[model samples]
Target: MKKYLGPILFFAVFEAVAVTLWLTMDHLFYLFNFTYIGGSVALGLVLYIRKWKYARLMVQLAVGLYMLIYLGILSRENMQIEGFWYYLFLGVFEAATIHYVVAKIAGPLLFGRGWCGYACWTAMILDLLPYKTPCGPRRKLGYIRYITFGISLLFVGGLFLLHVPDLEKVMFWSFFIGNALYYGVGIALACAFKDNRAFCKYICPITVFLKPASYFSLSRVKNDTEKCVSCGKCKTVCPMDVDMTDNARRRKNGTECILCLKCVEACPKHSLHI
Candidate 1:
């Protein structure tokens, strides 16, 4: 029962969100959507606790494909940063805005970057690449994310400011093109840097929102120094170069942790946990 507590708690939190939105918004889609995503995530956590190796990948595919193909492509909901800006300018509080708030913004205060590890459509594919861990020291190109963030905001703001015609159609097409660019750039950067998360480290504009809230994340990995041999295995396996042993809010790259648990698995002394 204790072992299953994490999954139960996760499911309960999402269920509360699902029910609240469904009733308040009077939309059955919210009920179905959040429930499915929550169920898949809970199932994955259960599998992970059971030592199933592919549990994370399974959840990523389930949530990523649903959001990317079903919601983005077929249903025509753009769930990207551009889409968030597009809807924000239009004063629409549904769809992409709601998603960003839940998954990337406020939600990180509770779960950190769990969405990056488990549900991001972009990272879903990137994680399948050759480099599960970084090959070298982190680069100083982090400033790129701020630039990309500005570009996305400006692009959408430009459209509204200029009163672009057929704005709905434009947004739809932008979603397609933006995802293509992300996938292309993400894959290329991964191969070039020998790091599967290179794109996430330097290019993803959503991190502009994810990082700040996650800095105060209630859920985080901690290391027990008494049990730790200081062999440096946790840092070696961390995809984001997070210093898990530090147990400080300002630990090196602390905001970059995606809760992937790779470091936890690599810890030889069983000193790391969330």
Candidate 2:
């Protein structure tokens, strides 16, 4: 029971959000949607605790595939940064806007980059590549994320400003084409940089929202300094290159942590945990 407590509390939090949104928005789908996502996350957490190697990957697949296929493709919701801008421009509080708030914005305060680790559809595919850890020098192309973020904003804002015809149809196609490009770029970057999360490190627009909020994340990897032998294995396994051993919110690449626990697994001294 002690081992399962964390996931239970998370489920309770999500359930509260689910019910609140269902009542406040007058939409029962909110209840189902949050429940399903929360359930998948909790299940994955349980699997991880039980020492399942593919636990995080399974959760990523479950949540990412549902959002990509059911929400984006079938329901025609973009669920990307561009979609957030499109809906925001229209002053709509539903769908993409709501998703951006819960997952990419406010939620990062609690879970850090859990979305990047266990939910992002683009990263789901990227994580499958050969390079799980960075094999070479990290590039200084982090500025590209800001450029991509600006491009997403301009793309949607420009369409609205021009009063484009069949806006909904355009957004649907944007969802389709945007995902294709993300997959393509993510894969190429992974191979080029020899790092599974190369695109996430340098080009993900959503990180603009994720980083600041996640800087204060409640559920971050922490180091037990008293127990640490300082062998430096944690840094070697970290896909995001987070210096988890520092145990400080201001540590280098601190906000980039995805709560993946690879550092914890790699720690020979058993000094890291989330």
Question: In candidate 2, what are the lDDT values of residues 87-137, reduced to their tens digit?
Answer: 898999997898899899999998888999999999999989999989987
Clashing pairs in 2: none
The estimated TM-scores of all candidates read 0.99, 0.99
| Candidate 1 C-alpha lDDT tens digits along 14-57 | 99999999999999999899899999999999999999999999
Query: What C-alpha lDDT, on a 0 to 100 scale, does residue 233 get in candidate 2?
Result: 89
How much lDDT does each candidate structure score?
0.95, 0.92
Clashing pairs in 1: none
Candidate 2 error regions (>4 Å): none
- Residue 128 CA error for candidate 1 (Å)? 0.6
Residue 110, model 1: lDDT of: 94
